[model samples]
Target: MIKKYLSATLVGLSLLAASSSSSAKVIDFEDINFSPSGGFSGQDLTQRYGLNFTGGRYGFSTLTATSYSGWGAHSGNNYAWGDGYNMGIEISGNNITLNSFWVRGALMADDVGSITVRAFKGSKAVASKEFSYTETYHLETFNFAGIDRILITSRGSGPVLLDDIDVGFASPVPEPASYAMLLGGLGLLMLAARRRKSS
Candidate 1:
């Protein structure tokens, strides 16, 4: 009976670990404050989201019916815009897996173009892919794991728009409840062993 209970406890722990590891977080850009002049730049997302933009100027804008046609926000009323040719996003606190995101070219005369996304682990490039987008938003999947930084570059004129970024931490911090459960499981195992020894 104790052997069966031990096996079941091990299985439960395995399932818990698997579930926590596979958890992903989606950043929809809806919680950010809206800019009055249509868009704003130099905003830091590190404190709230553990992401920092560098290499090029980055901004956030609220999507409008008059300015953008055919395409709309992927999740909320706002999205991130990148100026210049290249932008680098550095992930702080922990390495993350870049699951997927929505991207498209801004709705302007010269905004149609191809964009390249590259994932890096420190200084080494791990994965890269190029995607062509018009005014319509395209869902791009990377599945790049254990990456610390992501580089996005425009192959043509005009800025790139991004929304609904999905990412998962390589090492997820356990909740207090999780810790208590782990401790309880270990205590039960110890108690079972002590009882068997006494018998």
Candidate 2:
């Protein structure tokens, strides 16, 4: 009975450690407070979302009924908008796998266009893809792994809208001391099992 209990405890510990290490997050841009005019710029979202936005021309805005006639937000009332051709998003602490995101062309008249997404680790570009969109929002999927930064550039006539960025954080590596503790627990379990068998 003691051996069985120890084995279960060890398994539970392993699972707990794993569960704490990795997680998936979706940035919907809804939590940001927009101005009374329904749009705002120069707000720092790093503290709230762990994403540092470079290229000073990016901001958040609402997709109202009157404005952005054909386009809509992927999830909520708000979405990220960039007037500049290029925008950069830097992950705060660790590298992440950028899974997918929702995007659309911003202009009502010139809404048909393409955008290029590039993932980088440090200064090295790892992955890149171009996606085309109409006035309606569409999901763009990617398997950009081990990337610390992502650059988005518009290839069309106008700006772009973005929302629902899905990303997975890399699992935190277990410390050496954690491995030692696990080994010690296994040793204790083996010793207990031997004693029971001999007795």
Candidate 3:
């Protein structure tokens, strides 16, 4: 009976872990602490949500829609304005995929120019694409996989805007240890049931 109980518990735990590991998340730039109508340095945002940033070091500003007519808030009352086109944010873990994000030009009248998004693993470049932005916000999606870093660079000298960055990973495959624990528990449970029946 104790062995059966132990086995059942192991199976439940393994299943719970598997489910939790498969979930993904999005960063709306709304939850974190930011000065109202203020800018954040690149280092300030690094690893805030499992993401690290590099290059184009000036960072972005968090401002209200009233502060800038052209910068529309993506989700909440606030949004981020890219200081320039040269910076990129990298996901901290290995084997992450570039999912999607919302971006637009930061200027009220002039075009903000084009920006390029690139995904890389170590020194190897995996995928890249360029986008042109006007005054309106646009949602961009990517299917690049095995990415460790994502770099966004502007084609022009003007500032860019970004919001709602999403990232995902492949579903977690049960590790060998997890499988072993689960199977061992199940086998013990079955054996216990059979013994109980015989008795």
What is the TM-score of each predicted model, taking all chains together?
0.69, 0.73, 0.74
* Best by the lDDT measure: 2
List the pairs of residues colliding in candidate 2: none
Error of 2 at 107 (Å): 3.3
Residue 104 C-alpha lDDT in model 1: 75
Q: Tens-digit lDDT track for model 3 on 1-199?
A: 6676676777787675766464467777666544434432222444555656444445433333324445556777445555565654344555677788888766566756787888888888889998887767889998777777777777655666677778776555667787677777777877888799899
**Reference-based TM-score, model 2:** 0.73
Better of 1 and 3 by TM-score: 3
What would the per-residue lDDT of candidate 1 be over residues 1-199, giving only the tens digit for each residue?
6686677678777777776664578977677654444443234444456665554445432223222454357666766666535543444335788899998766575667787788888888999988787767889999998888887777656666778889887656577799688769777877887899899
**Rank order (by lDDT, best first):** 2, 1, 3
**Model 3 alpha-carbon drift over 4 Å, by segment:** 1-21, 33-43, 59-69, 89-91, 170-172
Worst 10 residues of 1 by lDDT: 59-68
Query: What's the lDDT for candidate 3?
Result: 0.65
State residue 118's C-alpha deviation in candidate 1, in Å.
1.0
- Candidate 3 is scored at a TM of 0.74
